[model samples]
Target chain A: MTMNKLQKSERFSVVKKILIIITSLFAGFATGVFGGGGGMIIVPILTGLYGLQQTKAHATAIATIFPLCLVSVIFYLTHGGWEWKSGLVVTAGVVVGGIVGALAMKKIPAKWLQPIFYILMIVGGIKMLAQ
Target chain B: MQYLWYIIAGLIGGVIGGMGMGGGTLLIPILTIFLGVEQVEAQLTNLISFLPMAIVAVIIHAKNKRIDFKAMLWVSVPALVTACVGAYFAPRVKSEWLSKGFGAFLTLLGVAMIIKIIVQKIKSKRRANK
Candidate 1:
């Protein structure tokens, strides 16, 4: 889609706002308790529940992460569990990776991406268990 | 049916995030594979949702004095700037390649984490043996 088309769709209706808010809250809570996974719920909620198109939903998701990361970083810092040097390094990596990943998102096809994503999840889950 | 999945996703995500792992590692895949969300949508959604939670967590951590503001400044400044750049460019990339790339990255990271844990455990054991 062209930039104009994407821009036009960016504006949210009342219902969309409500849905986004509700979804964002749920996502927030999940992130707090799980350490990550808000986006898993956010995307589906946006697409399935809120009716946003795929790319737009993704863009919106990135917009939302800023607040969440800020909150978590603060909490970690205050709690004394965070390693500043490590967090800085990781965050730096995430930023760079995130940009690259985002740019890549616009070029990749959904079909190939979805299955591979699923496989990674299953493997990750199993790995978590092993850990 | 869908709501059920959302609930499940929320629960799983919460647990994972609470533990300090990346929920995106799991969430993106579930959305794309089972829920039929596109890769871009799923990833963005994960990033977006992370915003509030990270903020809250940071607040709590900050109050408890866990935050490293000096370090955070370095990390967050770049993170914020890059995130915007990422968001702006994401949609132009094709979906499949992004998915594959993300998936591969996650897999490698997971494996590396596991390996690190094992190595740590062995090193500890050897230390104890001595």
Candidate 2:
């Protein structure tokens, strides 16, 4: 695919940098505590705030969240969450499936799925909140 | 049987995550609510599982040259500092509180996503009409 040519400035403004830092801090903290979901925060920051396109923002969001997950997982391992059996199983599945999803994302009509996703999340959230 | 469920949950979450939405948001709740995994353990699983997926994704994105590396660096640095601190404190927080907080987070995100999608749909329809 040819690039969209939204070529952002190579230079960063102090204001922009500060905003990025502040939001990143929030994303990182939430990821650490919640153990996942940093991408949600980072994607919008990349797209709406930084002017990247949807696909580019998604890719960059992945790159941004990787280190945060790595760091948080280490702390998790240190702090009594170290059950190798199940974690490894999940990891195996995730590794296999993540690659597939990453490849298929370009082909899928993601717009149709968004509504379902949000509804599911809302139902799941209500259940958890009640429980 | 349980292992199958574990893999299924992981697969579903991974696929969604690889699609760019946060897999952990869905995975954590699935594990805790459906699989009867404890809250902290569910969180841990999400964190561990995402790493490998992220590695693969980064490689793919790198190959496509989609990532903005400079942006990645700037965003990651500050996030790294606070993530470390947050991780350090995570296990110390009560599981109940953590679970509740996550529930709130998920609900808020869901609401926001719905609004965003609606706005997008309206805007797209308007564009098409024009």
Candidate 3:
């Protein structure tokens, strides 16, 4: 039974694999272009297409974005448009806050956070557009 | 004084980003709109700052066994190759357009997320009633 199940799972068609790759490439392009869309793109594809669990999708998206972000950084740096000093300062805060936030996720359920995040995004977006 | 703002922006963006949503969505706006940084500069800064935050978050999530390593392989390579493609075009785009585009993108993302949650809630409710 286990072997049969494994075989069944392994039988993803070439079309399916190609679709996944295409979706992933689009997600990466969005991430590179927006500098922030990786999770927004990857999580949905993982959950909707691959049927991964929500938490697992979120975690996996982060793992995937890590290398993609690194690659994007190389191009951004070579292009000479960034301020290293400001970037470093922000990074210091981001690193510390990231660890704290990750730990905090264990304490709070994601459902509770989603509404607030959406509201924040809307407000931030409106503020940007208004300016 | 300005450094303080940068740190604060980073910290907030980091926390949110570490939560599994991209920080650049929030960080870039905070830097560009609020802190008065240029669009390209803010974007670059966001990308740069994002690296460390993502790395740190991944570490924490991995420790908790939240990550599905197998699924990661499918996205990583394709994403890695295309990310540079996007970055290459970023600077060439006009700043005004970039700002407007980012704003529109964020608004759409917010709307989509809200709709998704509402749909999920209704579906779960129907399931429970059934």
The lDDT for every candidate, in the order shown, is: 0.50, 0.83, 0.81
lDDT of 1 by residue, B32-129 (tens): 66667665555544544455455555455556554434322322333344333344434445676556655555565456545544676799999999
List pairs with backbone clashes in candidate 2: none
Local accuracy of candidate 2 as per-residue lDDT tens digits, A52-81: 888888888888888888888889888784
Clashes, model 2: 0
Best by lDDT: 2
Off by over 4 Å in 3: A1-18, B60-66
Write down the TM-score for model 3. 0.87
Task: Give Cα distance to truth, residue B44, candidate 2, Å.
Answer: 1.2
lDDT value, residue B124 of candidate 3: 97
Docking quality class, candidate 3: medium
lDDT of 1 at B66: 47
* Residue B16 shift from truth in candidate 3, angstroms: 1.3
Model 3: per-residue lDDT, tens digit, A2-104? 9998777677655567888999998888778777767787888889877799888887887888887787777777777567788899989888878777788
* lDDT: worst 10-residue window of model 2 chain A: A1-10
Q: Candidate 2: where are CA atoms >4 Å away?
A: A1-14
Tell me how far candidate 1 lies from the true structure as C-alpha RMSD in angstroms: 20.4
The CAPRI-style docking tier of model 1 reads incorrect
Recovery fraction of native interface contacts for candidate 1: 0.06
